[model samples]
Target: MADVHKVVFYPVGNGDTTQIVLSGGRRVLFDFCHRERAEDTDTPEIDLKSRFKDELKAVDRDYFDVVAFTHADLDHIQGSTDFFELQHAKKYQGEGRIKIRELWVPAAMLLEEADKDHQQEEFVLLRQEARHRLLEGKDILVFSKPKALADWLEPRLNERGEAASARDHLFIDAGTIVPGFSLASDGVEFFCHSPFIKHCDEGDIIRNRASLVFNVRFLADGAYYDYLEVGDATWEEMEDIVRTTRYHKNDDRLAWDLYNIPHHCSYLVLNEEGQKGDKETEPKPLVKELLLQGKRDAYIVSCSKPIPDIKESYEQVQPPHIQARNTYERYLKEVGGRKFLVTMEEPNANKPEPIVFEIASGGVTWKRSASIGAPAIITSTPPRAG
Candidate 1:
């Protein structure tokens, strides 16, 4: 039998939650967003807690191999504190909570400060948990080692009678492959693309600018594929990634077979200075180059609400912008891409389902919706060699 790997994007309505199920049955989850109301059963969004638990039970597991929080944004970390068993606090542990064998966080998540009003929020709590894991020097990968983070962490290490550089191996930087999984052994490898040290060194830490981005490369039967998991980075940051990556002569990291579009299809991701006009927003030069790197039969997925073409939606200030959607669709066509999918609008907006893709020797194919009543269908796109 052929090796089959699965990638799933859950419908969380203007949020992000994706899972990568490797052929070996190990699972890696990215940026969970479980709306509290989704548990009602009548809501359009999936009941993330119940669904994830059920999936784990079927496999006789209660932990994810790795759970990466791209950033501390509310949309990405919503209800995450309640879903996972946090090691930092006894109050958050137990209660049948799922465990995270490894936690991945950007350095900014460790250095950012919250005001008194926001101190008790989930982001703050998650930050505490990340700090605890890093201090323990195991079961965590903190991306980027900036001066600010080092300055803050060194003192704590000294207080604990450990060397200042004790946790250096725990830090991952841009333009490098993550340590754990390798394509040769695990059929997958992750290349860090954003959250550079400079991103943290330059004044205050902007969550979106400092969020995590990775080029996830998957191998199957001598064929290699790339999936880009981008956080809510803006056009300036994307341009920086493109420029820096090219300067390092690691341009292959920019190419992608599947792209998780950033910031819920916000126009800022296309043009740094905001929308160009009413009709469509042209991507900045480097952003355009990044989009054009999509391979044949590529896919761009937006984890946002349904983007209607009506006048009200066109003039809206917030995301799920029609103009940005138009820009993405135009460039997707230029690359001979397969589809531009919106999580909330797939198979009708009223009852959206998780969008899934299966990767094997046949390359990548979009499978049917995971929702009940949807056809058990799969696209017949031919495989392409890496």
Candidate 2:
């Protein structure tokens, strides 16, 4: 426990949920989607609420430092309103449930068209909470928007003459460094890289491209480690991101020590037509450069269902695509110093262990859970009331 700075990927089936515990006990959550029940028999059924609380317990705290909703997809923000404190009420504060100190969201989440994309009441409530925070200028950080947010803040902010002041802390645009932020006391800098204004225009309904991708750079021992979290980005967006970062002379921004594969290893992220197992469908040149052109100790984490051999699972070739996994595996082996880890494949019994990576000056190492199967569901807190 040498001041462990770690990132944990929860095994919530073919969805995304990652927790980063920084050096100083500051916790940042990427997304959250827990299954009421696992769709596949092999997948484990776990209590998401309890699992999240355990992470809170690790820091001897009762809340997350920041909870980032990469996008409003059901698999990403589905159970948030229920799991975290959504209101500033006594009842919501003392249930052993954690509070979110800040909510990081892409501007796309505020769009009315995206509401249909997340018809769940949980999402509606989350939006309400975010709106509440934005109005109060409290626990909300709006990325990539001002006019739209200003419209929401009209009458008050427009009259106060303080709107210009809020822009320093409340608003962040793509390619911009986060204002006065870090992971604990670590020299970690998070750079916002997605939800470009074009993607959130009034009529844009494609939510995947609105993902809040960030390039996280931090100093460990003496070197810098870069972690890229791109939630469900399509190849089209990936192409733009790589090209834009390169053109800006931000090549270091694209270099990664760890990369969470986009869209859960979907073949579409690699190319247009799906590449089957062992098939040599050449990946888009830009994508090859993005993944292959990384630190020698680079890692690729697949947050999805266990990958099956291409021939065995070709009939329903969706995400966790065997061909995609094969492509990554090939790269790792060829590099001879890289790793490709999958959540479900972590060793354990009765359930999959969360895949945790501990970072230090030397490099990073996998930290396995202490016990197998999901922690027992908490009985003290009453069931969430909608």
How many backbone overlaps does candidate 1 show? 0
Candidate 1 residue-wise lDDT at 85: 97
Candidate 1 lowest-lDDT run of ten: 371-380
> Which regions of candidate 1 fall more than 4 Å away from where they truly are?
369-376, 379-386
Worst 10 residues of 2 by lDDT: 377-386
Error of 2 at 263 (Å): 1.1
Give TM per candidate: 0.96, 0.86
Runs in model 2 deviating more than 4 A are: 1-3, 38-43, 88-94, 113-120, 146-150, 159-168, 273-281, 348-350, 371-386
C-alpha RMSD between model 2 and the true structure: 7.3
lDDT of 1 by residue, 1-386 (tens): 57777888889999999999999888999999999889888888889888889788878999999999999999999999999999998999999999999999999999888899988899999999999999999999999999998998999999999999899999998999999999877899999998999888999899999999999999988889999999999999999999999999999999998999999999999996655568889899999999999998888999999998899988888898999998999999999888899998877788887888888887878886564223547754554644
